[model samples]
Target: MSQSNQQRIWQVVSQIPKGKIASYGQVAAQAGIPQAARLVGNVLRKLPEGSKLPWHRVVNSQRKISFPIGSPAYQEQRQRLLAEGVVFNKETIAINHLAWSS
Candidate 1:
């Protein structure tokens, strides 16, 4: 993706509240580029360490963390969400109950 598009993705991500989670597709749509969910993931993956953006506040459309199980990324994501009081049902979250209302 272009730098502008990536910036737009980051901008949308930054708006996600601390206790809320947004799907990749929802972030893409909010950034005005529908169907760019994978692109959003890519941009998020490339974010520099120590970046202030709330990258952890994103998940897949299934309300599941995108990182592989047992991976450090997966653990970190789950830990962060848990710290924010987000409840999970196995690998998936309750999307209807916790999805952010823009």
Candidate 2:
């Protein structure tokens, strides 16, 4: 990706603070690219393992973690968020109380 496009994606990721969450579409929109929702997911998936970008705080439009059961990423993300007091309803997080500012 070009430097500018990389920066744009990072700009959106950087705005997501600790203990907060934003949907892919919202992040794309906030970055001034409304149609880049799936692109946002792709960019996030490509982030290096151990990035400080708070990648765990993002999820699908349904507010559920996307990784498959037993997957390391899924378990780690759920554990991390729960450690931060994020409440979940089965696969979905309670967005009304947990939705982040965009």
Candidate 3:
């Protein structure tokens, strides 16, 4: 069930605290779908309006915001993360700083 999988991924993502972030792979693994990291991302990309999921807490393996700067999603994600005290360096959320441990 796509809806179930998306909900599961969101649950795992919600566990990440403010100012912290998880790799999509890490969230997928935590959600019992270790190979579905990209799926997690895809599902998140489909989240509808008013969804309360903390999707901004999920990033790429390199702890970078993979969304392009010109995209609205990219702006929202960056703003949300920054509001949560996440600091970025040279276009990436410094992996050394925000990478949440498994």
Give stretches of model 3 more than 4 Å off: 1-3, 95-102
Q: Which residue ranges in model 1 land beyond 4 Å of their true spot?
A: 1-3, 95-102
Residue by residue across 1-102, what tens digits does model 3's lDDT show? 355777788788878887788899999999889999999989888888888878898889987887986588788888898888887765677533646534
Give the root-mean-square deviation of each candidate in angstroms.
4.4, 4.5, 4.3
Minimum summed lDDT over a 10-residue window in model 2 is located at 93-102
Ranking by TM-score: 1, 3, 2
Pairwise TM-score winner, candidates 1 and 3: 1
| TM-score of structure candidate 2 | 0.80
lDDT of 2: 0.77
Q: Mind sharing the TM-score for model 1?
A: 0.88
Residue 10's lDDT in candidate 2: 77
